[model samples]
Target: MLREALDEANNWIGKVPGVVMVGEGRAQDGSPTVDVWVTQPVSLPQKVKGVEVRVRNSGDIQAQ
Candidate 1:
């Protein structure tokens, strides 16, 4: 199910031109878990369709 969620997230990011997906994982030492972050323009309107996953230390997701 994680892959499905990630794939869905990637689809939304793909809509943006010149957008890149960056994924980060955690280590056995339990240091930190990094995730994919999409670099989009802040000026873009909310009219665009896509899912949003928040990168937080506590692991929270917000989809639209």
Candidate 2:
């Protein structure tokens, strides 16, 4: 179930402007969770398409 949400976020929701990467990761509390990597600190909705969106930083993104 968690992995499915990760896939959906990668294949579908990743198209969102701020989304950087979507995959399985750990919650801040160190628990297993899904991750939605982003380049900025935007206020994302609590969930996307019913799956909770956990936004993490992608550090520095450069296209050069």
Candidate 3:
């Protein structure tokens, strides 16, 4: 279920500006979550497909 939610969340990448990365993770309470990393603050939903969406502000990312 969480995997499916993560897959659905990945679809938001590129479609939303500032979004750099999307992956699966565990929330503070140990519940499943979809992690979203962005270069700057952007509007995002609190949850997707019943799973929590955790958004973090990560300055611009560069490939090494």
Question: Per-residue CA lDDT of candidate 1, range 1-64, in tens?
Answer: 4455556546664455434543444446743332444444322232222322434232333558
How would you encode candidate 2's per-residue C-alpha lDDT over 1-64 as one tens digit per residue? Answer: 6767677667765787877777776666765566778887766566645556677899888788
Residue 23, model 2: lDDT of 78
Clashes of 3: 0
Backbone collisions counted per model: 0, 0, 0
Over the stretch 1-64, how does candidate 3's per-residue lDDT look in tens digits?
8988888888865479899889888977899988898998889999899999898888768989
Candidate 3 lDDT trough over 10 residues, lowest sum: 6-15
Model 1 clash pairs are none
Q: Which ten residues in a row have the lowest lDDT in candidate 2?
A: 43-52
Q: What is the alpha-carbon lDDT of model 3 when measured against the actual structure?
A: 0.86
How far residue 11's Cα lies from its native spot in candidate 1, in Å, is 1.3
Q: After superposition, how far is residue 18 of candidate 2 from its true place, in Å?
A: 2.0
Rank list by lDDT: 3, 2, 1
Judging by lDDT against the true structure, name the best candidate: 3
- The lDDT per prediction is 0.41, 0.71, 0.86
RMSD of each: 11.5, 2.9, 1.4
